[model samples]
Target: MAVRHLGEFVVIVCLTLVTSGSSYAEQLPNVVFILADDYGFNDVGYHGRLHGSAILTPNLDRLAGEGVKLENYYVQPICSPTRSQLMSGRYQIHTGLQHGVIRPPQPNCLPLDEVTLPQKLKENGYATNMVGKWHIGFYLDACLPTERGFDSYFGYLIGAEDYYTHMRSYNVGSKTLSGYDLHANKTTVYQYKGQYSTHLFTNKTIDVIERHDKTKPLFIYLAYQAVHFPLEVPDSYMDPYMNITDKNRRTYAGMVSCMDEGVGNVTRALKEAGLYDNTIIIFSTDNGGPIQSGANNWPLRGSKGSLWEGGIHGVGFVHSPLLPTSVKGTVNHELIHVSDWLPTIVAGIAGGALNGTKPLDGYNVWSSISGTASSPRKEILHNIDSLYIAPEILPSYFDGEDFLWRFLARVLEDKFDTSIRAALRVGDWKIKTGPDASASDVWQPPAESGLHTIYPIEKPNQKVWLFNITADPLERTDLSGKYPDVVDEFLQRLEEYYKGSVPVRYPDPDLEADPALHGGSWGPWE
Candidate 1:
């Protein structure tokens, strides 16, 4: 084994640590997850996204104040991957889904067999309710929320929707305002008439909480479709920001504020129902925002679909009344990834939640929150898209494959620079490996030159190399040639990490296909 790989193993080992059945702290706590669409890192009051802006997110601000605020957090580069990671506790590729924010008649959705977080929680006696967007994938109806484990489901299977109309269009035959219906026990019993996406979803969640059997706790995965594209502010929120200068951004801010209010409503409902203290509400975005969604991500470059920090890095947290003082208001600096949600939540609920799967990828931050331990990921891989050399359940299999292909073709024309495009930041050192020269300009490796080398560390002077990320967060300078030994080690780790991905099976097919009935979709980003 190479010394660099050895160093990487050491880093991962320190992360593994030792654990047993339960830590006593892993008690039964109700779970509520609010996933914002196209949300930026600094958008909320806690993160200063709305600090000097006209946007007012008082609800989220209050939530952060009452609970803990997480700074060092991450999701996939786009919506699909994040939902994939959120549900299966595995990497996007492993889950068998590709494409972020799929169009209606969306193809190649999440595969069946992946054990969802709700299913795991259900095993330990938690009623699961999923309301709002279910954008994991929708080639078929099986991908819906209820099929995956939600006892009750209400929301569009696609990514985003027209708030007022409860209907929108992606194409001629593929347009339908009414989203699919998902149910666990009785189909008609769970049937509902969808309203303005946000309000309707929130009302359903409140109803679920209000009517849930308090005996067995509950897990509500509230995936909000707010603040995404096809931007529209409900009449209520639009009145305030409607008067702003930038029409798009004004409505965008209004959408964000309305979403924040929705979150507040849910939290208020929890408190009103007396479930607030016992519940652990996790807040995060499915992915970053796009150009049309509003430029909330300033300091960070890129947005939504791009693989930059602004695209993959979004705000997130696990708010529980039981959070230890050490972890509260503290930004966990350890390395973390998307797949950890399953085990992390399990770790919180302990015996009350699940016992089927071992620690997959994500670490339970609770112990670290208690100041008893820290996470292992220091230098993390924040790839937004699937790194699959090939894809399973490819688009060719779907009847709508041709349509999706055309969409992809149109999107590729204005594609971002892949060559010299993507970058990586390991502590202070940053290495940028853009879209392959061959990928865009057909620059062949070896035929020209493509050797793995490190940056900022010099041993054998190499010209095109890496740099110190801390001193130059923008990664303006290339010091790979300046430092050979250090560069070589870091380069090796990147190689192995890219080459290594333990694939997990897709979730149950019925669950995956349940939400896509009647060819429903969430516009461009859905």
Candidate 2:
């Protein structure tokens, strides 16, 4: 046996020949990764059984029942971070996307040198296709999906856009710039103007499946634009949720249902194309739902942009006829991060090599998901963002008659600077540093309940928070005061991670990216 090093990856070469009856002789399975935008923790029907949610997600529920549901999965707090990590198999700190998302006009994108998941699949004799939102970056043609290892791409270049009009508006300097965002590969597609993105992307996915060559495996990354902002959906889809008084939640539910229907349609297409038997379907959300936009995380605390479980604890599941019967229809509580998908699919499933790639922070968890072994990952570096700014201080639980006194007392004897926004998870313990006074740090319930309650806000002086997530998943109790030693250890770990982080790539919005200047379409300007 000999060991060979390829970039940061290690490959072992066995000198002995393998038997013809080995499992490695089998064909590779097709992969379909569906990513939902701004999906809440409690919005799915499977979670509704415990939270009594009014959202209708029959298709998603059925898919979960036939697969291993990921109850303890984690994503980044925003769109680009999660997507970048999913594509690169690296953390945000490694990719320089540690803070915020790629704004429409920013002269930035995922570093071009990074080896993406699609590229790896393509190397393994797979047809790679991408449909829907490409929010990572588009300032350069090198940043487009087609240029990033995908054979074909159909999607918007930025984040949220009008569902029917297919238009996105953002301020470039003093002017609010608006343009058509729908595209097919590198060309701006205008024919899809009136078509809803959820259905449009779904149809494209089916087309890809129907036209795929059977001899070669297929890899589809369907990043749906559903359940995101804009709050627009056809009225027919919302009729069932008319009971919900809140207009936004009602529309949001309809959006979810429409996406669910699309999922069922895609599955049906796969079956019709004879690809279902060997296809592995994985579903996950980009981040937690934004509470201000009529989405609810409910029992989980915090909203989209915060460092709480509600912001990063995502909905994920894996379904395939290839999975063992013992693992199907089971809930997995093991810790899994979004970055694990790249290696899991490339090396674990496709039997591909990871040569020429950078050091991957992800581990292939196929054995764990397949019920053969426990997860190899025990710790996850959530993030270390130096650019994070705490929201405006408001008079909540942090302010009272004795607030000034307590603030001065804790400030004088602080163990770690709480202003450094970072979080880390080691085994059952999770630690977060930085001020947690963001408006997104509140539990949002379903709109149909018509019940509103105020929760205690984190004290202003309290910069560090420690929670045993396995014991207290809701994160209601803060053990920082009780276990100061644990907090110190986690802080030191965070510091080590911070030292390895590259400079953030958030650049100022460029006027050249204005749609009016680019024939009314958003595309590469550099």
Candidate 3:
């Protein structure tokens, strides 16, 4: 490992760390966890995969320059599941969310029995704060952030909302304007209506940091609603992208740029408050960008909803002065999962292991990030979901006697069946099995200059495909036929892993009380 000196600070961009022998004092380091919703792989400058992206994310690039880029970080395919795993350090199947997200007004949430990150951190004398996008579940007050573990909560309750009005939309043309989404500590604050949500969330985060008591360590979870759907941005942001003729793509770029600026403001606030050096900053995306939302996860396979590489693999980095100066501006190719953050953060502050609790599917990966040790995470069960045919079992999937029966069977039986969609990554090999494995969400480049291509649906395949992901990150060739023994061993392992999983927890839709909110269409309740 080569090292250089920048002023009195040693700089090392790509090397292992030699510990500085820093000791834990009375003032533990502050944590600022920044999560981007549906951010793309190629959208940032550091990835070096997207040849010429219109997006300019200077703040994110700066973060990469200041810290270690996690080259092999993995996350769940969608918002709620990823957030669930992140919060509890467990799989979504164990936590009551398996296939999709938690729709509003449904009596569902992160299971009360499970321990959350904030809960554990609060026990360790940290001020827990959350700003923006808490999509886990909020039907009941107990399910909300304030009731969970966050000392303070400021953000929208449901999924994607109108960037300006903050109203939850049911379809492209219909939105419940009266249904208030924005809130500050469980109370709706509509006065900030018409304000750009991305800016408002950033302002709230900074305010928290400014007013935070310095006596104890702080935990700030800033989840940005940027570059998602319902695209809207200030003219100043979009003006620079006028050369890009694709209007949706142009708006998307502006949104990303606005987010980048917000990140700059956040780090700036930390410096202004003299808390920059004592902070551990984490920047990562919730899931892959959706093509319909004009996101470009190029050179990877799938989109936000599928189990392919694009949907699960995401951007991540950790910046902190606590790490040895020798690790600055480096890249860590260690495998990390969303579930690892809680234990990792806890261990970093509490100075001990979280033993005597339920065994977690995640491991503390701080050593992996600091380059002190190789990643302990050797394999990950990406996901296992069956065809969720809502039409056939609408109310039963959520409520009613049928739901009770299904729920009981799920928890009581060894329900791992052949009819399931799943993916597993162990060592250098990745194996995916399902009816939808071959379905590609990749958007092709346009033949005409300056125009963005439309989203195309790839034909599905029923057979499995195996690849040595380390060698073939693009998954260009299937090695299953040539390596039959390897494929068989992986299949057996996947099956055993599946049988050990808990049943999927379905929230009650309660149709009689509230109708199912359909996307891309709107109608009155039945």
Which candidate ranks first by lDDT, i.e. highest?
A: 2
| lDDT minimum window of 10 residues, candidate 2 | 11-20
Ranking by TM-score: 2, 3, 1
Candidate 3 C-alpha lDDT tens digits along 1-526 = 0111111111121111221233224456788999999987777866632545767888899888889999899998899999988888887756657778877645577887777888888888889999999988776667789888999999987788789988764431243323557888867777998999999999999999899888778899999988789889998998987887778778888899899999999999998887776788999899987766767676677778877787889899998776667678998899899988877777643443465335577777776677667778888888877544323234435676587777688567543332367788999999877644224445433111343544433333334668899998866677877898887788777777766667776654544223234221211223
Candidate 2: where are CA atoms >4 Å away?
Answer: 1-26, 389-416
Residue 6 shift from truth in candidate 1, angstroms: 22
Per-residue lDDT over 380-415 for candidate 2, one digit per residue giving the tens place of the 0 to 100 score: 998988877344333442667987876777566443
Question: TM-score for each prediction?
Answer: 0.73, 0.91, 0.84
In angstroms, give how far residue 160 of model 2 lies from its true place. Answer: 1.1
At residue 63, give the lDDT of candidate 1: 69
Which has the higher TM-score value, candidate number 2 or candidate number 3?
A: 2
Q: Encode model 1's per-residue lDDT on 338-448: one tens digit a residue.
A: 666676665444333334543344555455444455554455555423332112223333457486775576356433212223345566565544432121111111100
lDDT of each: 0.58, 0.85, 0.74
- List clashing residue pairs in candidate 2: 418-434
Report the backbone clash tally of model 3. Answer: 2
Q: Order the candidates by lDDT, highest first.
A: 2, 3, 1
lDDT of 3 at 71: 88
